[model samples]
Target chain A: MSRSLEPLLTSRYGIEESWKLANAERAGAYEVARQALTTRKPEELREEVKKANIRGRGGAGFPAGVKWGFLNRQDGEQIYLVINADESEPGTFKDRSIMDLDPHRLVEGAIISCFAIDAHVAYIYVRGELAFSVARLEQAIADARQAGYLGERPFGIDHAIEVYVHSGAGAYICGEETALLNSLEGRRGEPRLKPPFPAVKGAFGMPTIVNNVETIASVPDIVQMGGDAWSALGQLPGDGGVRIYGVSGHVKNPGLFEAPVGITMRELIDDYAGGMLGDRPLKAVIPGGSSTPVLDPRRKVDAPNEDHPLHKWHGQSEIDVPMGVDTYRALGTMLGTCCAIVMDDTVNMVEACRNLMRFYKHESCGQCTPCREGTGWLVDVLDNLCNGRGKPDDVDLLVNISNNMMGNTICAFADGTAMPMLGMVQKFREEFMDAAIHGLPDGVRHDDSVRSMVEGVA
Target chain B: MAFALTPEREQQVDDILTRYPERRAALLPVLWLCQRQNGWISPEVVEYVAERLELSTAIVKGVVTFYTMFFDEPVGENVVWVCRTLSCDLRGGKAIQDHLEKKLGCTAGHTSPDGKFTLLKAECLAACGQAPMVQINDYYYENLNVAQLDRIIDAHAAQGGEDAAAEFSTCATFGAPHGSRGGSVTSAPPPPSREAVRLASQPPPANDEKGEGS
Candidate 1:
């Protein structure tokens, strides 16, 4: 397949050579920038992005045009665009790759987005812990300013747009757009209530549009290519042109790939990721990022009669059950950040849950009471299960705690924290229960591995 | 208690503050500059930032503590921030942590005995494809394992070799260097991509050799 028109591999592209505005201009990158700046009206710019059907690539494949449309136009308040580059989701690192390789693409996209929303300032909220990324973005911002692409009245536009790169203090909650704004404003990173969604009240209590790095990065291309042509690129109903899904664990070619949304897990694993490593059997797949529920390989009963150009659609009946934004949502999980984590038979379900619990516990911002305390409790519970100290009641306790933690916190950080525990209990309740049952189920000794651990050492 | 900004430092602060419409808006960048000057964010220096930004001491204090990058406690002469995210975890970041603790006799989040180094476990350094990575000051060292980590520490120890022998100095208030200027801290160099795989895939000392026998 031709590499042209694909998601640019950030690693392959040199920072100063292929990524910056000057490099893009030299390589015909700003052909669209020039047009968008000089010719296209702001409203037309919005319409074109809408037509391109570029869905947010930071997960929850919301249509970029529609999200931008949500902005409540105020007469005097300045609109802002915040790029969420907090790529802290356990399996999601595609944004990090893009930012590191070609931060300029994001800058260019943010500029176009700012122009569309009538915004004057944009902030890229990177994870505070990522020193290298923050530095890369800092250098890119400096370069953009020098090239007259950013800073006051850039590109001769009457409106002034100053791009700021703010590093978060490592809160997964900050990944939630509103919480990110809170942190940027120098407050504890906590999610704000909706109704004042970022479009209404965001960074510095102004109208803001928080888009994923990949979403804004796609804007330059959409502006270059006609919106309809870009929209046509996504064959699925709400499918977008290209996505950088980071695949990890047990995959042969484990790395980041740019594929259309309709691509199935099987194809991504087989064709793109070069199938399972060492020819091992695939046991489960976390289709989206770490937060999405794990799907059993056996239960992947592909809906009969599904058809989509990009997907492995067999017939028409299965179209409603496709794997992109429309389908993943219908299946009760979002294609959040497209971090496909593969697990083989060798992966113990109890152990996986324990590992995920550890991540959620470590990353929790300790803002809301449920999330702050609930994450650690979940991990402790799972840790007990993994270490074979689990009781039958512990399973219910996990579900109860996770259930309480959902949607009750300041941020969706609570939800990302809760999803894995609920998912493990839902999918592998039997495995957990079997591990929990000790020496004997009915007065007969069972010499199981879990039993030995629970019975105390020999 | 205030760390007075030298005339030149004041000018730099003024330049940055002017860029933002509101003085409070420049809190993050100004604090970053402050940390660079002091090597760590002390309460007194934070109070100084509070006064310079015209923000309440509480506000500056809140901002400084909220962000993880700014260390409240004093660190070693060099800061090595290790990424403990999934990508790094998959490629043996835990092993690197083990090696670091062994080499420096300090666990993650602890400063070395001689105060020559401090190991901090950060979330994501954003270089995932390289897997297991660390950031020394500002540079990213990717595709790391135990040996790569040791080599990095050794190199730093060698460069700041003399400083390692110094006693722990509990720094109090910020001291203005002569000329009303802050210390010029050099940014770390970026890692060469060619060395990623070899550096990341290096096996540990005993276990790797034992596996070779099998």
Candidate 2:
């Protein structure tokens, strides 16, 4: 793997009182935004971002420039830019850190992005649970507006710009772009059917562009350094720039680290996160957020050619696979959010699957039948398997439910839930069979007595 | 009794309304304001919000029920949310939830017998790096073990409402000082006393010409 790059996204993380506009400005916050607004045309800025190859960090990994291209900028139609700051994916916390610590960077990015897309108004839909981040972001917007960087004719440009902070009342599905638009409009936080995608008719029946917090936060840097120069920061050809990889669960120093896109899982766990907690042997890792498929180091590559990026680990463990969008996709998983949750050897695979299933079931928006019902059924079987009540065919039943849920929903939520469900069961089939036939191992059974005390909490 | 916003709060509602293009789009903020003034969203408040936003009661109620943060029923002075997602769970979040239940003498999703706290199991709070954390009111108590949690609950129990809500500090190592002008933290104002809310729910005397206040 290449040497770690200098921090771009996280540069302001450790600065004292970085959330303050003055401190952020002193650290060179809005210089690029000012320059871009004064000197660059909207299309010029958009093309630069396209050349930089910055993907959406919220989870989808879609290129920001491509998403911008889809916008129907009809004359006299109000254009809206919505920032997805909902950061609710189970193991992802990078967006929260950015919003909490260096909110001005996000504000600057939003200012430039809105200008680039010809949007005069932007609403940042933050998860209601993150009260602190919401406050910080709101403050930053107010400060930027006061400093003549956000309101009408900001920075003396002819175009007007406005940014507002809107909070979600704790709905995970709102993280989905369309659902976020609905929630912003004070409607039920349910996913809307797509073809009139947010690009064309969004946010009160106007042209809208929704971009993730991290993706927008990269704009100032891309503008400052020039697109191709910024793109060269990544190890891979297509995947450009650094990612704030967040590591949690059984690591000594579990926190966010800024590294190039193709950094390996071993590098993240060992070099960045200080390795496993107490130096325990690695068991498995959810390479991204909870929705991503779990990767077991013990599993070997099915087929590896010399030309493949993962060829060296063919006979050995696949633990050292590079963490990138294409590489993970090549390995039958995704680099969703790039927030890894590491598991040590002491953890139980069955219980872990149950933990994640319960989350997906609780978060399913109920808009689609397959996701609403399939998630619940998966949880029930996992619960049964964990509590020594599993039927012999429950293993097959779990797989069957997961297979049916995939690609069968209005949104990708059902598919995300099924990815991990199927990943764990297939990777650890024997464990599921063992739990089903003989119940969870000695200390792994569900504590129903305690559970009853907290029932209906969801 | 019919719910009515004070003149000042009505002005605040009007300001929030201007931010959105449509009046009904301000429903969430208006609902939040109602919840802040009262302990929870009573039926009367629902009707008042619907009227204020020019939305139907059914539309307002659907929104309230859909989102998790809005409370339809009265809760204790403090609401404690224990995150039970995978990252925290792997780091002993479940044990902390169990401990809180035992200590508070109530199950999750219910207020304690003393009416001091309402314990709820939260989804991933996006603070996994500091695993095993709980959000008390609007402040987050992170990197918690049983002992740390005990001290926090005890302090809140002793201090009571607003003071206690402001007393606990965040474990965030960087950024502007929380609650500072630059950061400007906005927690749900300390809930009104249960007795006051109950009294407010009752109808006024039949002889009164003007109901409560204009």
Candidate 3:
């Protein structure tokens, strides 16, 4: 099927100074917000969103409409809408591009989302590392407010609407919805225990809805093109709309491409990314962000029989699998952030795992024991293996620790930390074992040079 | 020296305080202002922030130490962060680090003897499309090779170096349409000159004060 759909979220990207409010409005920016506020009731907009089936673009693929439906909306209680712009997930840069290039789109989407949920206030929690994105977003909000699209009685509506840009200090844990809440409340960026989810009790003890930048940015387009039409644009049934797939590392054209939901990985790398850099042989691909399990393009499934889900790809490599949430789940990985990190044959997998593990170790919020300790343990073991001091049992030990770390934390941070390690060590067990028995290949730097620079600042 | 926000910065802090419903919620932005006014977040600045927001020093210090961006101790005049993640690593990120260390007369985590530049490693600045990039203060210098690195370092080493480096736009151009294949490097202006490398390596006169805030 031809999955090349017209760009919705990224249409304003290439335009000169698209971040400016004047340029954005000329390209039809806040017309949805204006129309939604004037013509449609909040309930109608919410129902339409529910019908559209837009999933969160931030790692977790939860339905955005379902998430909004969980809001308590108790009388006399304040409701909040937080935009999770903390795009710290390694190999993910799509959200940054949106906030940087088309801030007005996000501003308009936030307005529409708030209007639907009856939330008068919204906060865009952006990562501090993205200073430029923050500046652009802040400017957009200012211009939006000045243009009478924000503040009390926005767009001639009777309700009050306010939007603020909040900057997060460097902490990957803050990307978690609850952790983001805690960070916004001026606490340590640590995840809180569940049962009282954000929809029930969120920021500052209010009913809050946290949506990803891309998820919220998709709202304007969804509202303009009716829910069913937007739903029809996807290659898969429920996976609606086009997703911005970021192709980085060892690609001829390492950039972001807005393609349909069910486009194949081979198409992304070949047609969009212009194939591998220097025509090198593809070794493996992190089909999502670094948190998701790595996928070896050459590995064929060894399913027991035809009844198994893996049977369909029993003898085929995962390179051609259609990219979607359900498809990746069946393949034992996730379509996380849809940002693929491609590795060529010349790259060392062990060192690469160590590099990613180090990031998880440094970013672990100490609230959960497994993530705080297990991430460190994983990094140390991987470091030993990479530096030739590994024991024979280290490979199995890595899997054991990864198994223990899974499903043992307040949030999925530990699981995220463990999944990639398990994926790398288990998928490439022979390579790790070879390195354990006989050190890393010559010319490989053994020094602890990969130590996080954030450590030095701390 | 005692920590205090300048009159203008104090006004900005007041404005920031109005954005959040609670006073403590403004702590992060307030801390950012204090860090910008002064070079890094010292104990005095932490105390000042706590007093300003009615938060305890313990809470303020806990926050300062938790984030990687807030420097507790003094950093160099210019903080250069080179991303060493897997994506950048596959595209010669290590060589960039090695070249930086040699050129700066310092290791990845240390500052130069003259306090001109501090070289540090970063995870990912979300500019992987232009791999092997570095962030000098608030601006990102991407698609860097040895020659490009030299030009950038030399430009920053000279007096009012940031002005000379102003040609490098902070805004990313990677958002261009997919068909155009607009890598960030394509948008970057050509190199200035190789003249400042010697000045950068020699470390002109020592200036204890940090570079101006972003």
Candidate 4:
């Protein structure tokens, strides 16, 4: 298949002067918002989004339209649409690019999303560390409001939409929807229990829809072109639109690429990314953000597609995965946040896990006892293996901790932290054991191994 | 000398307090202010923050301990926050840390013997493309290789560099505030002076129920 237009979704981002809300408005940024206000009913808009088949960009491939459909049409309580801008999922930085390059895109998308959902209040809960993006977004919102695109009586409509930008205080758990709501409500960033997912009872105890930056930003396309047209934008079956994926590590062009969903990994690396940098050979790829299970470049992903629900969910086994949303799911992982972290041959998988452990352990909110302790334990085992002090069954122990931590916590953050650990242990068990045998390679400094081991394993 | 929260600072603290519906929910910002004043969250400052925010000492401690941004232990005169996120990590952040450790005779999490510098490996500071960066005090030195970092450290340690060091002393001095959240330091009021604090302490307006009435 011939490649489509190269810029894709990033076409607007190139024009620096066009980044302003006014320019964007003039260029049809708020056209959808106006359309939602004047032309379509809120329920009709939601239905249209459902037809678009847009999926959540934050790791999970949940249908965006379906997620939005879950929001009850009753408008008694104030509805909220929170933009989860906490893009700290290790390899994920596409959201950052969106917010930084043309925040008005997000503002436009958000306004349209709010209109579609009948939410009068929208909050952009930016990660604590994203100062530039926050400023950019705040400015975009102010500009949008000045142009009557946001705020009370926006887009010449009877309904008013108020936009607020709130900052998270540096915690990864806040990336989780409910956890983000809790943080916005002035609490520590920890995930709230499900059964009352954000759709049911979210920010300030009102029904809310929490969406990733890209997911929300994708709304305008669906609103403008109609859902059917937008649904045909990507590569995956029933996928929608080009994704701005951040591909790093060993890639020649270690940066962001806006590509269709069904694009193959080889195309992403070899064609878009210019292949691996230097002479390093491809070893593995974390197709999504850190949350997805790592896939060995050599091994095929065997995901079976039987008619049974159990088989459909679990029997999905090894296949040569591509970069699309469906392909990622087929590989027992989701095209999460699209933070394609590529690992080359030179990288010691054991050391990489150690690096990842430090992140997981540091970012764990410590809300659940299992996640709080489990991440520490997994990190310790990985640390020992890296420091050449691994025990025989450390591999088994890592898996055990990871297995126990999955789906047992208040939020998916626990599972996010566990997935990488699973990837490390499952895909590179021998590397870890070998490191334990050989010890810290010559110059590798082993600091606090005893401390990390005692604390991590115990 | 132990610095106390000036009335203006206290008002700022109170404003943060009122933003939260729960009176005691403002512990993080209050402790942050206290740490800024006292150069660390000492036992006394934590107590003061706890009292001010209507939170217990342990509760305040828990918040401080949970966040890596809040330093529980005292750091040196200058804190070097190194970004260790994926982009920076790929861009040789580990190598830079090693070099800094060798040059400063301290690892990523330790302070120098002379109480001059404390190196802390931090999460993403959002300057990913410019990897191997360090926020020395308030100023960020980005795109730092070993050579660039050496020049930075050397510039600080050079003779008659105290003035320069003071000018470049904090991450806030970099013009743009660096964080995933604080909306940059531009939004933050400049560090309060002692006299400003004293003047802020005198209560005047009665409509202070809006949290931090000065």
Off by over 4 Å in 4: A1-8, A17-19, A22-28, A73-75, A301-320, A440-458, B1-61, B72-79, B85-87, B102-106, B110-117, B124-143, B151-214
Q: Which of the numbered candidates is closest to the native, going by highest DockQ?
A: 3
**What local lDDT score does residue A9 receive in model 4, on the 0 to 100 scale?**
51
The residue-by-residue lDDT of candidate 4 on A1-458, one tens digit each, is 22324443555654534557765656667766777778888888788788878778877878888888677635577778988888778776677667766678788788878887878888888876555567678788878888788777887888878777776656777788877776676556677888877888888788889898888887777777787766776655677766776666555545566666666666666665556655467877777776777777666444355653224324222323446566566455667877677766655666666777777888888889989999899878877777677877887888899899998888887788787778777777777667767865643446422111101111
DockQ each = 0.14, 0.18, 0.21, 0.07
Query: What lDDT is reached at residue A184 by model 3?
Result: 94
Model 4: how far is A218 from its true place, Å?
Answer: 1.7
Per-residue lDDT over B134-179 for candidate 4, one digit per residue giving the tens place of the 0 to 100 score: 7665455554546556767777656323454443322222212123
The candidates' interface RMSDs, in order, read: 11.2, 19.5, 13.6, 20.5
- Tens digit of lDDT per residue, candidate 1, span A1-458? 11124443232343233445565567555456556876789999999888888888877677889988988867788888889988777777677655655677778788888888888888888876565567678888888888787777678777677887876665676788877777777666767778678888877778889988888888887788677766665547656565666676555555666655565677667666666755778877777677887767555434444453324433322212346776676555567877777766655666566666777887787768899899899878776766568799988999999999998986677787678678778878887787676512332112111111101001
Model 2 / residue B69 / CA error / Å: 0.8
Best by lDDT: 2
Model 2 alpha-carbon miss at residue A31, Å: 0.8
The lDDT per prediction is 0.65, 0.80, 0.79, 0.66
Error of 1 at A200 (Å): 1.3
| Clashing pairs for predicted structure model 3, backbone only | none
lDDT of 4 at A346: 51
Better of 1 and 4 by DockQ: 1
For the second chain, the TM-scores of the candidates in order are 0.73, 0.78, 0.79, 0.68
TM-score of each: 0.83, 0.91, 0.91, 0.79
TM-score of chain B of 3: 0.79
